[model samples]
Target: MRVAFVSLETVSHRDTETNQRFQTVLEILAARGHDVHCYCATFWDDERATLERDGITYHGIATGLEARRSFLIRLPFVLAASSPDIVHVHAQPPAAVLAASWGATLARAPLVTEWYGDGGIDDNRWTRLAANRGARILTPSELVATWIRERGADGDRVETIPNPVDLERVRDVPPGERVDVIYARRLDEGANLESLLLALAELRDRDWQTTIIGDGPERAMYERLASDLRIDDRISFAGDCSLEERIAAYRGAHVFAQTAEHCVFPTEMLWALASGCVGIVEYHVDSSAHELVEGWDRGFRTTSEAELADAILAAGDLEHRTFDDRFADYDRSAIAEAYLEQYRTLEEAYGLL
Candidate 1:
């Protein structure tokens, strides 16, 4: 089937959880023999050039304030040229999704979208309308799916597809001493990484190293917090490590932990499981991290700093049955097949066959 994916800017554009999942799904669909092409923004300098990596063809749409406009302007022409069976656009920003919906309508193809943002509909007034207009809506967690339904999307129109992990690529690295605990997230205001830093400080007496990955506006404040706690020496801000480095870090780590209270998807935790690290995540009402923890027994949830530390310590010694079974469900190949079936369903529904 021919599929067109419209993503404004994903983890592929930035090294964050959502983008990682975006790249993973796109790659998965492409590998499954679908004519998958991604329309994303050139958010960074390197993104200016177009390259086809993994199994997908990527076209860097455009950048800057005019990105949305440019995407809408060129998308119609691109769709005319490709004439895909289905167009699956991602992200929750109303204008973007709205434009994609219009494009799908003009192209005479089914439009579907995926959302993993807190502002699923509440982010802006247009969001809820655009989502409701789409043929289908996908949420990475049941929490997000419920949020979509509350915003007026029909329950049947929304599907819960958890984050996917490429289990094969995550081979256990040459066994290394398990002493490092890793936290990787965008240094964005919403990340709430400070809580995790404080939690780490509380566990200072324990023989463990803390590594912070990724960069964003919150870097300075987080660095100051580490210094203030006198845990600066123990914490290393390994800013923006490559995909390979991240996998290696997970492979060598004893635990992968985070303090992000809200999640559309937990990319870091997926990689953690793939690397065989015990998962430690914060507990919050809005998060899908619990799905990762509950779905895979390799993780534990805690609401307090003390509990988080205790959970991490306990996770290191516990054996999880859920890991083998649940992990299989989220594996890359299985995820690819699921997406292929979804595409087929869309094709049949639209009578595009």
Candidate 2:
């Protein structure tokens, strides 16, 4: 089947975890003998167009038209060239969907969309119109699905499909000697990292060290908080380390913490679990942290700094060999296969030939 994946989100050549998820899916689909084409915003300067890297043909949509205007200018041309069996769009706020839905209509193909986060929905009329035109609206978690449904998408059209995580890259890392804790994700408004910093300060007094990975607008604030907390000496800001470095952090760290208020599918959490770290999840209404800790003995859900401090202290003492054994199934290959099953189901249901 020919699948055209239109993503308005940023795609870095740096190979961040977020980008890796989409890359992995593309590779998986290509390996399964499906024709996959990625129409994504080039968020980097790496030059190599229409090349085969991970078993898929990648076409970077060069655009200066700002995100809001991108759908209007590029969708028709992309649809004309790809002529896909299915039009798969990533993210929402119906502007892109509206454009893609129209292109799919023109090409006589089904439209499928993946809504990854809590982007506000203001155009109810347009969203409803688009939903009626779409074949399926895939979400990464039940929480996200609820939000999509509230925005006028039919309940029957929603499917929960998470971002794929490759566990092999994590499970095979050589054990490190340092007792490190990791926090890897975008440092944005939704991520309440102050609590983690305070907890780290408390743990610092107990001789614990933290390794912060990832770059974002909130990095400076977090740096300031670390300094004010007097734990700067014990914390290391790796600032958006490469994929190899991320795997190393997972292997080196004994505990992983996430303070995000609305996490959908945190790639770091999956790595921590696959690498056998004692996972510390702070509960928030919009987060899928609980789902990450579900059925795992090494994960703890907390609501306060005091509880987080306690969890950190306990986490520092967990046996790595045992914890790794507990989360062996959370590996990447298994997650990829699960995604394949979802795609296959969608293919059959939509009669993609």
**Tens digit per residue, CA lDDT, model 1, 123-208:** 44776676586677887888888877777778888887776776666663443334457888889887788777777777788777
Which residue pairs collide in model 1, if any?
Answer: 11-19
Each candidate: RMSD: 4.4, 4.1
TM-score of each: 0.78, 0.79
Candidate 2 Cα deviation (angstroms), residue 332: 4.4
Off by over 4 Å in 1: 7-23, 38-82, 91-108, 118-123, 191-194, 200-207, 214-237, 319-326, 351-353
User: Candidate 1's error at 296, in angstroms?
Assistant: 4.7
Candidate 2: Cα lDDT at 136: 82
The 10-residue segment of model 1 with minimum total lDDT is 318-327
Among the numbered candidates, top TM-score falls to 2
Clash count (model 1, backbone only): 1
Tens-digit lDDT track of model 2 for 43-78:
545676454555666666654226457555677677
